[model samples]
Target: MLVSNKLLVDNDCPMCKAYGACFTRFNLVDNNTISPYQKTNEAFVNDIDLDRAKNEIALHDTQTHQTLYGLDALIKITTHKSQLFKAIAEFMYPFLFRLYKLISFNRKVIYPSANTAVGRDCTPDFNLKYRLVYIILVALFTGVVLHEYSVSIYSFFGWESSWFLEIVVCVGQIIWQYVAVKAFRKKNNEALEYLGNMSTVSLIGGLLLSPVLIIQSFVVLPVLVLVGYFFVVVSLMLLEHIRRCKLKKFPTLLSASWVLYRMGVLVFILTIFI
Candidate 1:
């Protein structure tokens, strides 16, 4: 099952590293063929488009001396493994390709690398367009989840449920975090990365609510149960926010500010706006 090809991945990306290791461990690629473009010799690196490879992984054919990239390279390895796997890969090419691009484009911000090596770096260039896309999509999801949750619980707290309020709150979070980052006088890139991570936390909380949302579609749960679960999700989101903030070496007070914004917004919506 050993394919005679070298797969070059970003050593800094945990996803990429795990991908390469999985290929090697599963005998999908030859032993010692999974390499980091950063550490690979210039001769081997010169064999492929280094820039393109940085964005999408590169697979160099050791035997034919040819190169394939991104999903094509992945399909190539599967082609060597078995007809069934190869067929499945080709069948799901469209969805998988988009998913690959989404992950590839945001990999750095998804898990910012702390590696400051002096040698060649394989870190993908930060694409603001994709980063914004990620943020917007996450915001939309969060907004929808909040809108639905508010509808379910507003009556319990004697508060009016406004769909528009949920959307405003979601958008407000982005602005609030941006202001927080600016208050600390962070550089533009750092600010953008922090915003991306913050949006991811919101996204995580929304996803955690999804199952309960689905259940609510069929069964009306008690208000206290819904409220308690919401708080539980929020607690987890808070811990994750703290962990990611620490990962980026951001100030601990940033997490405090993050929680403060949500609390302030909740108070405003429940008391004044409603």
Candidate 2:
């Protein structure tokens, strides 16, 4: 619901401005109520309550008789297109309302504003240089893996038969990847963290199955292979989650390079046994 006032308004609210920009780009202006209201019978708009509007922006859903104010209004405004925003609104709106109430209750202590800017500085400094270095290294490793894969595919002698050695190599690779991911996450690199967590779990599973693959050979190998394949699938799911999270950038090419190295090590072990 939108209430329009026929008063010249200063574009002050950052959240409202950002949402308005998004709405403009989306061409979703029909439902919106902009200020300096013209005398028209638009279903979305009603006469503005100056006192209520002065406190915060108000939105009323006529169908539901649901009214939203302040942050709720902002969230409701964003809820039309973005599912992520809707989820956030549903989960966080109550919490925000409570916080606002608490702050309003303790205005002096919480916000000692002497008619000046009274907000926490929440600027993001994305240290892209360090991230670039990390990306480059990962890319180099990926290149090595692709090269190795091409070489191995062309040469039948490159195939590995020793499942134990393959598992061991996989475990080692996973551990290294995990360490890299932890480091990245420490710097708030969520994309690396997701990949690292997935790889760590997969490697741990592979490590557990390594000894079993060695001892039981024919009996355990098939079962472990199936289990290992399941881990791979889960890892892929985690990767998809990471993608959806939109952690600034995509995972580096070197993210799966360890797998190629493990493949090479497995091939060498198989050759020795043959």
Candidate 3:
């Protein structure tokens, strides 16, 4: 349900202008009657407390007069997507709405609007240094796995399988990766750091597992490993670009793309084992 800015003209302010620009850019304005009260002919201007409007944006349900503010307003907007966003809004709305209200109220006293920066300002050196440790660890694990695979080829075929050792190495790698990520998060490394860590982990894992080519004899395994490695490298390069470009805030598009790439890696790994 797209709401039009024209419907709420009586209360138009700078906030409204910003919201209008965002809606227009997203092509979400489907109707000329944008205000929640416009179609219903309700006197929202008179009914709603002006004091509340000073601190919060209001969106009233036409049928119920139910007021939504902050994150509630965001969830309502996301509902129109009716796909991924909709599902996320549905699942996250209840908790997020309360959190938004709590933060919004506290922000009025603790952090004024004038002090808040529009976007994040994180340095490339800071991000790279933060992630370098994780990258080195992943590289080390990759080297070890590759070495193991190379040695396994010459060990009497089927006489003594190294499958148990492979499983142990995989589990150990996973544990180390998890610990590295946990530490990174605790340190509040920027999105670039997160992306770098993800890419390094995926690439290292894929390269190490490439020796699967010798034992599996499946044409798909090598292709999967190569594709995974390519994505990891590309993702890391894009993250580096994000820092250099000083693009819009942290959590850049590259970070999201890395997540999808990691998901693909997970699926490939599952397919290989199962």
lDDT of each: 0.84, 0.43, 0.46
Candidate 1 per-residue lDDT, tens place, 139-188, comes to 99899998887687887767677778788888998998888898885588
Instruction: List, residue by residue over 228-251, the lDDT tens digit for candidate 3.
Output: 654565466445434522432333
Q: What is the lDDT of residue 220 in candidate 1?
A: 94
Q: Indicate whether candidate 2 or candidate 3 has the larger TM-score.
A: 3
Could you tell me the C-alpha RMSD of candidate 1 in Å?
A: 2.9
What is residue 80's positional error in candidate 1, in angstroms?
Answer: 5.7
Per residue, candidate 2 scores C-alpha lDDT tens digits across 1-274 of 2233122111343433445556545654433444321222245345344344434555555555455665666665557677887997788868876554433222221112222223322222233343333333333443333333223232444544333443445455545665655554565455443443343334334344345434544443344454465456546644643442343243454345444554566586556756
Query: In terms of TM-score, how similar is model 2 to the real structure?
Result: 0.26
After superposition of all CA atoms, the RMSD between model 2 and the true structure is 16.5
How much is 129 displaced in model 1, in angstroms? 0.8
Winner by TM-score: 1
What is the TM-score of each predicted model, taking all chains together? 0.85, 0.26, 0.30
Better of 1 and 2 by TM-score: 1
TM-score of 3: 0.30
Query: Pick by lDDT: which candidate is best?
Result: 1
Considering lDDT, where higher is better, how would the candidates rank from best to worst?
1, 3, 2
Clashes of each: 0, 0, 1
lDDT of 2: 0.43
